[model samples]
Target: MNVAVSIDARTALLFSPCRLAGLDLRSRIVMAPMTRCMAEDGVPGPATASYYARRAAADVGLIMSEGIGVDHPAALGEGTFGERNMPVLQGAAAIAGWRAVTDAVHAAGGLIFAQLWHQGPLRRPGSGPQPRAVSCRPDGRWGPLDGSTSAPPDYLEAVRPPTVAMTDNDIADVIAAFGRSAAHAQTAGFDGIALHGAHGYLIDSFLWPETNSRVDAWGRTLAARTRFAVAVIEAVRAAAPALPVAFRYSQWKLQDYDARLVDTPDMLAALLAPLVDAGVDLFDVSTRVFHRPAFAGSPLSLAGWTRRLTGVPAIAVGGVGLSRELKDSLMAVVPAEDNVARAVVAIERGEFDLLGVGRALLADPDWARKLRQGAPLPAFSPAAFATLI
Candidate 1:
């Protein structure tokens, strides 16, 4: 089907209703979780709730909150350079803050999920407690550790490097933290929870060999590396059995940028086996561009491979609504209007289950409503990020 014809017909598969863990989503057009750095001390406030509620009111089926930190010291950090409002989900106050956001979304007739995250090595060194890098090498150290007082240290120096490796006890503690966070999310009125295992964070750190080079039980083979994520999933399931847990995985790392977990199909299956057994209700396969083939000579994209491998519903993200790739448009002062026509066509083709609208939604909270009504979409300006707060 042509873009214009699809847009005209308004028969997008994305608008189709679906059920996840007994929660009925109004449609498949999920508002992808985008970090706006607007949280106050890791606690989302009134502005955050209003920003998300607007989208829900406009018809977003599922709203995944930006990566929220569990109650862990390492997961909490100061704001980055140029980020005046970087938020962290740290203590009891932070948990209560999120409760407000969840309550608001629910009150607005929307289903929302919190994206649990641990910045891992991404925490700028020296800015907070010693940051942990996937690799022990200096280059891999969180950001940089230079003691310069002038000119904010490079991304590396801002974060503290993890001096001590996680022991079995530490691992267990982190798992319990995730469980506690999940339970807190339930109490806060969140409909579901999504584990942020993608983008070279804590969970992905354990999955990659370069970062997780230990010879311990959690570091031998691919199956072994999957141990940490499995623990987390099991813990979350145990804590909130009624809440659907979605696992988000990606091939790329913020450190390496071009990293890949599985170059072959067998390897891919090996990496995913344990996670599947751990009770993940959904798989969110992240890619810079969703249409690209996952492996050579394979018609399947990353999302397709994930669904085929796990037999679970998968959410495909990356450049979904944009006319061009988001990675390329990041520094652009203004982003182009979303091509809902193209997005609808992809949705109809069953490339994946959900369409995650990112910057487009950020620019216009009512983007989905506009599409549903076949109204003209507004241009996406990066300046909207600043004004949204």
Candidate 2:
């Protein structure tokens, strides 16, 4: 197979600048948030900044940082995911650490968004006082990497922890923590903030029915399910009115790949109404395959449906330039050029606004720049994760 280095008519438009609400991006290529577990003591170190800066320097339109925990009690730490180190958005050291990251990305001529996250039901055992969740559901023995991913090994999920149900006060504290995190991101110089509402995290845990069977106001009905997500969006919006708020959501879950937030498109529209109303400027739709049709009849992807339904920008992600999202825990990634062609066709037809490249970006930092200059791309190897390359 012969692949050229020159930009194609199909992808040329993708290189053009686009604006999402108040956020301005140089191109339509968004580097999907991938956790590297490099932070220690809740502070992102120099190596973390350099890893992100490499992609910025190579011309990724926008970069969504790895999920950073808020200052909430149920957030990442002590009782959850003690297997790997995650950066935090609280405390002076954490703030200064992320400030360095934002500065590095900007210095490289790229814009970045801080993803505010809370662990929710996925907290590991013995890491904190007591494991708490939307309901008393246990996370079983294993979990997936994120809420959206179908691939497994549960990234750093705790081993079979009994989770206690969250009280009203507990919920309020988590929401307040998210707001404080957003304010911190603004102070750190991020162009925008992304709420990690997808995956099997706290916000997603509340939205889905399987994890949230509460009969209280926070659950039981569709509107009630979204109350937490809406609150998070509203809180972040209030904390940083000028910052573009992007929400990353998915219909699937690590616990159940076949799960659906709203089985039909209409249900999806209704589910998103309150969040959009609350002030989400963009929707980053996460799917396992970018080009797969989201619903039964239409050829539109999840991101495609989002833009049409909400009248806002949508980011399409998942196998953007790869044959598979990931081969396996060991093999990791494989190259499939057809995925790129499929993305180009979708973009040409207005299926989605921003194109998010995940494992491909992790495997190769020059991916966007090379595609722009018509240069050949290299094969991806799992070994890339072992270094800042």
Candidate 3:
């Protein structure tokens, strides 16, 4: 806040109240979901409640909780590393645990969404709490391991062999698992549901052609590729009819940062049409940079194209209050206020409905409040990944 005079007044726009698909938010600033991998035995404890409540109390609007595994056996696993202590959305203990989290956030005057997740092909077979579960790949491929990837050598070698492609039965079971989890999230008192359909996960695997080479109804062209995600969305809607549903998707994958799902605006529009028809209330378009142009012809960002094409409210994220992308090291320090200024301009131009802030919030629980008060913000550090602080 101690940076530019140009955006002094417009910065207040981020702190203003806005309604997203009828879910009223206290402000336009959303706490983007970040994986913490701290829930023991797939259960969140009181510490989880405290972590979220602190941010809610400081006026961060609409907290999207860390990805909670669905009830599927292949839901949670060691992806890119030893992904231990991840939470799930089933059983009385897990539901009760999440209830406390929702209550705490609500008590602090914040609306929260449960990001239902399934690791898909990213799940290292013979790993996770359920070691016996099979890794569900779309075409029995883990994608090209030679691309620009952040996965380690050992992990790459382990998942190199093609696993069994998802049979019709396997597809049905995973879709059912997402529905069951949505019902549980509603029971736990969450305001809405957010689907982790991005970053080379289950739903995204079907979206990306490189991973999903199937000739069946579940894959092929962009329209056909949407079948899996559409089915998942329909199931969630059926289970929790009243809850708003948001879908998060990205062109880049954990397998390859340079991977892309769509190359042109028309292709992007084609990819998103079925999702809107299937009842997606919001689109969380994940990009490495929020303002970067999604395609060659237009200057519109991915989130911008999503809202324009689908007529659905979209959340724009990535490097919002930081100097670099998610995979880059945060060792170098730079004032993040410049990015916040850019966010104001984008929002004013109606680029996106909500601004998703990740690392900045992790670095400071009072990040939203500090912005509201025009106070200096703490620079993001690598150490922030060490703990739940």
Candidate 1 residue spans exceeding 4 A from truth: 1-6, 78-92, 128-153, 157-162, 333-349
lDDT per residue (tens digit) for residues 293-375 in model 1 = 89998877888787777777778887765656554554564345445555566556665677777777888788788778766
Candidate 2 deviant stretches above 4 angstroms: 1-7, 77-83, 128-161, 327-333
Which has the higher TM-score value, candidate number 1 or candidate number 3? 3
Better of 2 and 3 by lDDT: 3
Poorest lDDT segment (10 consecutive residues) of candidate 3 = 329-338
- Candidate 3: lDDT over CA atoms? 0.88
If both were scored by TM-score, which would come out higher, candidate 2 or candidate 3? 3
Q: After superposition, how far is residue 148 of candidate 1 from its true place, in Å?
A: 26
TM-score of each: 0.87, 0.90, 0.96
Candidate 2 lDDT over 14-42, as tens digits, reads: 78877766667888899998777778877
TM-score of 2: 0.90
Error of 3 at 258 (Å): 0.5
lDDT of 2 at 151: 33
List the pairs of residues colliding in candidate 3: none
